[model samples]
Target: LTIVCIVGGGPAGFYTAQHLVKTRPDVQVDIYERLPVPFGLVRFGVAPDHPEVKNVMNTFTQTAQHARCSFHGNVSVGKDVTVQELQEAYHAVVLSYGAEGNRTLGVPGEDLAGVHSAKDFVGWYNGLPTNRDLRPDLRCETAVILGQGNVALDVARILLSPVDILKNTDITQPALDTLAESSVRRVLIVGRRGPLQLACTIKELREMVNLPGTRPEMEASDFECIAKMLKVLPRPRKRLTELLLKVAVETPEETELERRNSAKRAWGFRFFRSPVEILPSDDLTRAAGIRLAVNRLEGEGEDVWAVTTGEVEDVECGLVISSIGYKSLPIDPAVPFDPRKHIIPNTMGRVQKCAGLYCSGWVKRGPTGVIATTMNDSFDTARTLLHDMDEGTLDISTVKPGSAGVTTILEKRGVKPVLFSDWEKIDSEESKRGEGRGKPREKLLDVGEMLKVAWT
Candidate 1:
């Protein structure tokens, strides 16, 4: 029997596990997750309001239910249990930990108050354990976000949504309640690149514009700013613009009709030009807004967009969040690292220097694509693993990973990995808490609060 131990219980891991069982029922698979539960990005990466985009969980759960598979939660690969030990315990091991770190803005004032990373802010709202306590006090009258992706749109919408719509979402209680109490009225989403070069997918773009109850204010000046950027781009960028423009043309009608019935104010979703410096808040200690230098396309070859000369100016705002991108952080030492790409150097899914050991998802291919693409990536890795398993090609099992002391250490140290059952209780309690407030399930942001909730 082929016993496979899969690390990282995200889409890639689950999909690879599913394929192994489906293709070879004789293969017994055990999935180890660092978190107490499954679903990596879907659980913590996606925006809470976007429950539809998160429907991928259903498919992942069904796969995990297979008779040949079992998931061990609260178990880490590198720290708690190393890959070498898993290899010894199982015939083969697959590493599917996706890109785990937030790509930084790489500028000063990133540590300032009211300055938030899209990952930290989004993860906080989405209930990621590490970021659950992150509360940005976005109630400022104006907020600035750097990036032009769906994430930026989500932040903009969340900033501008009526307290009512926000009350019903899966947003953590701290975030939901804070925003409901926030005085923030305006948001500016800044992008370094031209509008045509924006990294958002069309499906994600529509959800922002056509949110259920709110129509965000789009200033004519902002559209003109974006239009200037769009005019300079090549083919697909123009096409994307035409489509977004059509959406804009139809927005006033949507707002007019929605206003006839609902009390929800329009949600403003605007894109600002390149960002130069994050201006401090009116008080100077907190972020006031951003100092932007208008960018112009310069490089005749590679679509280089840079700040032009003497076009610097400031826009007043309260909070700043950078929704730039994601990068993979090196975890497993066995896999060779490429600092440039933040991914393991590999062909398809095979790690270059190491044999048998391989990577998939963001770690192998760099951070890109959605949940579906993660599945496709893992399938490719699984095939390669199977081929290598048959040949007994690479062997690097020198230091065995031991889980014997893990449970004891966690128990003695008072570290409880939120198990699936623990998560269920947390889920129920959050819902009950929300119901108490006449809102949807509100999350407990603090780790102490979460642990207490789990215990109770």
Candidate 2:
């Protein structure tokens, strides 16, 4: 029997295992995750209000429960075990550990009290154990988010959505309580490019436009030349641009106008502006505002780049969340990592200069695309691995003790691996707790509590 090991229990890992087990009946796959509970971003990164996007978890659950596959949680690969060690126990090792590092704005005052990365901010509300104590002060009147992606929109919607709307979601109790007392009335989503080059999809933009009790405060000038160029763009880009035009340029009908006029909260897009520095509050401890450098597009269409016009603008805001992007961190000194790209250097998911090693998802390519994109990417990697095996590139002739060997190593180190059954126990407890609170699930935001429940 051929044994394969996959690091990380996120979508990439699950999808790769699903393909391998279904395609090759003799292949046994084991997934190792750092967290006691499985489902990394699906459980931690997805916004509470967007539960529909998280339905992918059901598919992941099916993969984990497969007879030929196994899940080992609470096992930190680089720490509890090394990449080189897993290679010895399994015929092949696939690294699907999704990006966990966040890119910084690289500006002054970024270290201020009110400045937070969207990765941690999202984690705080989604019940990621590490960020449970991110007690962000929502007492300010305005918040500045530096990015124009779907994540940036998710953050804005969560901040401005009515408490009644969010009460039913899986948002943490602490986040819900803080949001209830929030004084924030406006949010500015700043981007370096024009509307034509927006990174967000139409669905996210539509939600913002239709967000209850909130009105769009877009600048009319931002969409001046956008309409004339819409017909020549791709269908998706054209549709997205049309929506932006409707929100920023076109006048709404009477009923819609009334809704806009009566909105209690507001959000706007600040296009062609790049963050230069985070302005500090008096006493110089916390973020008071942000200084933005005005930018102009250098090229036409979606291939445009932002060039600073040397004009500066300052907006007063209490909180700043940078949704720039997520980067993958190096797992171990043994693996090859491209620090500049923040990804494992690989071709077609095959790790460069390393035999029997592969990678997929964000760690293979830079962090981009949606869940569907990740699915296709992971399947490609699985196909490549199978191709290598059939072509005699991967030696599966020798009998290797997969999890049994890893278990022995882990036992000596005193690290208890949480098996799939153990995770179900924790899952059951979280669901039972959520039932009391009228949510789908109230996650255990403490590793110790998760392990206690898992082992119980």
Candidate 3:
């Protein structure tokens, strides 16, 4: 039997495992997750209210329960067992550890109390233990998000969403409480380019437009040349552009009237602005505002780039969330990583010059695309591994020990791997707890608490 070890229990890892198991009857797969829980981003990055996206978790759960598959959670790859160690024990090693690091804006005053990365903020509300203590101060009336991605819109919607609406979701109790007390009423989502260059999709944008008791604030000039180019763009981009134009231009009179009457909450887009620095308060301890350098588009369509106009403007707000993007982290010294691309050096899922080793998802490519894209990428990697095995390029003739060998090594090191059944126990407890609060499930945000519950 060929023993395959996949690092990371995210969508990429699970999808790869699923494809491998379905294709090869003689293959046994073991998934290693650093967290006690499985479903990486689905559990900690997706918005609470967007339960539809989390539906993918049901499919992942099915993969984990496969008879030929095994899940080893709370197992840190680099610390507990190195990549070389796994490669030796298994016939093949696949690195699907999705990007855990967030790209930072290299600007002054970024370390201020009110500034946070969208990754951390999302983790905080979604019950990731690492960010449980991120007690962001939402006492200010205005909040500024420094990107136009779906993540930026998620933050905006969460901040402006009604407390009653959030209470029904599986959002952390602490986060729900803090949001209920949030004084923020206005959110300004700023980007370096115009509406045509927005990173968010139409689904999220439409949700923002229809958010209850909230109004959209857009500058009419932002959509000046948008309509003329709408017919020339692709279907998705054209539809998105048309929506923006309708919101910013077609309904100007109605929107103005709604803005005058609606006093609940408001959000707006500030285009052609790039962050120069996060302004500090009088005492220099917290963020008071942000300094932005105005920008202009240099070209048309998708090739457009932002050019600084040399004019700086300051927008007063106490909170700033940077939703720039995510980057992959170097797994171990044994694995080859391209620091420049922030990905494992791979060609068609095969690690460059490294036989019997592969990578997929964000670690194979940069952080972009939706779930469908990741699933397809992972499937390709699994196919590559299978091709190598069929062609005798990967030698599995030496009868490897598989999970039993790794279990003995882990036992000697005093590491307790959480099994799929063990996670089910934790999952059950979380669901029971959520029942008391009328939500889906209230996650245990501490590792100790999670293990204790699982062990119980």
Candidate 4:
């Protein structure tokens, strides 16, 4: 029998464990999560209104309940236990800790008030303990978001979404209250490249267009260059580009005028712009605006790059949210990591020069893709591990203790790990709390509160 220790309880870890338990019944898998709760990003990163996307949690729940699988929450790998310790107790260790760090803008005035990373904003609204106190001042009317990804769209949607619509979702009460008092009326999503290179998908874009009381503010010139290439591009890109063109240029003048007159809020895309600095208010205490360098695209398709056009412009805004990207952090000194690419050194999920060690998901590949992408990547890693076991590349002859061994070590360190049942208790309590308010769940926003509930 082989004992496998996965250092995350997110989609990657759950998917890998699912495959292992189904294929190799002889294998016992244990998932260790730093948070008291399971379902890392699915619970904390996904927007509260998008309940359909979170339906995957049902499948993950099944994986966690498997007899051969066990979940140990509130277990920090580097702090609570080391990678070497897991290796000594298990036949293999799979590092699937998804990216927790956010890439910074590295510009002036980033430290100013009203400037925040979209990661923290998402976490703040989603009830992440660390961002519970992120009381973003939404008194300003104009807000600027840097990036053109789904996360950027999500932030925009949440900012512009009707309060009544968001009230019934799982959004934290504190965020709900803050947004209710928001005075923001316009959101400008800026991207370095043109509309053809937008990183967001059609679903997210459609949501923005259909948002109640909101109208799209797009410049016709941004779609002129991409008109001819729409039909020639791939199906998804072609559809997305066509949608943008229709929304930006093809709308009837009468209907467009009516929308402009009637809409209470608006969102728009700004292309060919890169942030040079976040301009500070006169008092230097808050973000007042941003300085952007005009950019022009070179080449075509995925090979395109943004080049500065030697012209700069400043747009006045009170809040700035950077949704550029998520970055993976190096786990411990014992594991191999590439600082340049921000990924673990691996070949097809196998850690380089290290036997019985593997990685998958965002840690194995740079942070990108959706849940489906992570699922495929994690399954591949599990298959590779099983292959090695059969081929004798991984030695499973030593009958090592699995969760029991790790539990003893954690107990010795005075760490009370939250078991799978304990997480279910937390889940039930959250659901019960939300039931009274007509929401899916009212998440606990403090670590101490979460542990208290879990242990009880």
Candidate 5:
């Protein structure tokens, strides 16, 4: 049997397994994940209010239930077992463990109390086990988010959204309680680029614009030249820019004007600004505001860079979240990694200088694109592996014990793998808990609780 082991239970891992099993009937796929629960970012990073995006989990569940596919959760690749060991036990090893590290703003006072990376903040609200204790200080009225990506918009939306809206979602009770009493009414999403160069898609921008109780307070000046540029831009970008123009430049219609006037909260984009420092509060224990260096775009079209103008401005706010991006960390000593790019160095998902070792998703490419992009990228990797096997580049003639061999190693180390069936038990328990709260699922924020439910 051609036994393949994938080290991650996220979208990339499951997508790769789905392709592997469907293409070759003899291939038995095993997925090992660090968390007892499956679906990585879908569970821990996506905003609770966006349930439709979470529907992809159902497809992953179907993949896990395949007779030739097995899921082993609660197993850390580098700690509970090593990559080298998995390579020995399987005909091929695919590392899909996604980007878990955050890219910092590299500014002073970044370690201040009210300063948080968007990853941890998203995790806190989404019931990620590690970030459950992150009780962010929401006593202040204004929150400054440093980035203009979709994640930045998500953070702004969650902070300014009405408590009643979020309470109905699967957001944890503690987070719901904290948000209910939040005094924050203003959110500024700062970026170092112009509207034409925004990283966020139009859908996220539309959601932010239509967010209840909040009005767009964007600078009219930013959209001044954008009108002439729209005709030459791509269709997707043109539509997004037109929307921005309507909100930021053109005079609103009667109904829209009334909505803006009546909004109780406000959100806006601060373009051509880059964070210089996170200013400390009076006691110097937490963030008070952020010092931004004013910038100007140096080039035309998408090939532009922010150039500092030697002028800086400070906006007073209580909380500062850096939503720059995510970085992939080295999972094991044996796997070749590029420290600068924060990704595994690979050619079409084949790890350089290492046979039978491959990677996909964020760890192969950088953390970019949506779930569909990840699916296509993972399929390419699986195809690459299959090509290698057919070309005699990978020797699959010898028997590899796959999960059976890995289980023996894990047993020796006193680490019990949570099987796919066990995860279903945890899922059922969570669903039952959610039924009491009138939500889809009330997530168990504690890993121990998840393990207990699974074992029971």
Candidate 6:
């Protein structure tokens, strides 16, 4: 029987496996994941509080349990195993490894101790093994968060969420303690433009504004800015406009101020300014303040917001969280990646030049949509693959399951592949350890912990 070796265990990988095995019962499928456990970003990327969104994992697990499917954990391309070997051994190789990196907000003071990327912060709270100890040092009077996306909103809500309310969740050790001692009294959410243009869903914004510690408040000028934009903003095809209208009509100025004040009383923010540069707080420190680029509404009426010019000013903030956005990472040399788009170059699901290679999910398309979108993408790829199989055009070389030759080749090449059992033990240990802490499972962050949990 032909063995289809799938790489990654996220929504795309397992979905594809589910499709491939269901269609062709005679075929054998092996899913290889770099993590000791499965479910890539879903296990670590989505916010922990939204347990409903994470229910996708249940379906993924069910798919993995198919008789024709097997899982091999802790194996990676380039370091743990070579892409060329899988090409030679398996009938087909599918790369569903979603974007593994976050887009950096390349700004000054970004490398400082108190600054954190939203990606790291989200992972720390969501139990990504690589960020179990990741914590935001919130022991500051003021905190500034840049960007206005859903992820940005997530960071904002999490920063303001009650520490006691989060005790039962699978929060990282450092994050838990930091929240318990968080000295952050005021949080400033800065945007380059007004809130109308903020790239966040209304639901996410509400989650932030209505968090337990504080309802978020808006400055009168901030509301004015939003109201003014609403009167003249164009109706675009994007859903953002729909949400904009909903906010403008449903929430007027009187209630807006009340809600804003409520949020302010709870957790306040300063809006409508841009950050020019981050300045140091003292004469002898890395950075203790931010040099804000002041702005003014330039155009009058329709033209009023058309131009904005600013003088420079400095603002003091103890910590900064850059919540820019998420980017789909380009595939490494191990896979055929489109550098310009950061996607795996493929025709349908098939890799363009490489025979017997396929791609699905974010690597194939750009990063987008909910978990359901990923599943549909995988199902499409699987259909294309099945077509090739029926025509006998799929040329798979002879290879045995867990064979001696394969093991020798991996060892000789210094590729330490993580097998299925390793992941089970890692899973067991994490769950068992979590019982004492009254959490779901304690994550293993960083490369060292991952190795110890999976291999040692």
The lDDT of model 1 is: 0.70
- Where in model 6 is the C-alpha error above 4 Å? 132-135, 220-274, 283-286, 292-313, 328-334, 397-406, 413-422, 445-456
Tens digits of per-residue lDDT, candidate 2, 11-128, equal 8999999999999998999999999988888889888988998999889889999999999999999999999999999999999999999999999999999999999999999999
Per-residue alpha-carbon lDDT of candidate 1 for residues 1-456, written as tens digits (9 for 90 to 100): 666777888888888888888887657777778876578888777777677877887777777678878666667778766666565665567778888888877666667788988888888777888886676776667777788777787777777666677677677777777877878755666776544566676766666666655544554543555555656667766777766665554445665666534634344434436667877655668777678776666664335655566678788877888888878887767657899888878877877866556677878787778777888888988888777766667442433232333445546655455555576677688778888777556766556676676667
TM-score of each: 0.83, 0.99, 0.98, 0.98, 0.99, 0.83
Q: After superposition, how far is residue 204 of candidate 5 from its true place, in Å?
A: 0.4
Instruction: List the global CA lDDT of all models.
Output: 0.70, 0.94, 0.93, 0.93, 0.93, 0.70
lDDT minimum window of 10 residues, candidate 5: 397-406
**Model 4, C-alpha of 329: deviation from truth (Å):** 0.3
lDDT of 3 by residue, 17-70 (tens): 999999889999999999999998989988999999999999999989999999
Model 5 Cα shift for residue 394 (angstroms): 1.0
CA-only RMSD, every prediction = 4.4, 0.8, 1.3, 1.1, 0.8, 4.4
Ranked by lDDT, the better of candidates 2 and 5 is: 2
Q: In model 2, what are the clashing residue pairs, if there are any?
A: none
TM-score of 6: 0.83
With candidate 2 superimposed using the best TM-score fit, by how many Å does residue 107's alpha carbon deviate from the native?
Answer: 0.4
In model 3, where do residues sit more than 4 Å from their true spots? 252-260
- Indicate the residue-level lDDT of 97 in model 2: 97
lDDT tens per residue, model 6, 199-247:
6665676676456547444554555545445546565413454454444
Q: What local lDDT score does residue 417 receive in model 6, on the 0 to 100 scale?
A: 60
Candidate 2, residue 385: lDDT: 95
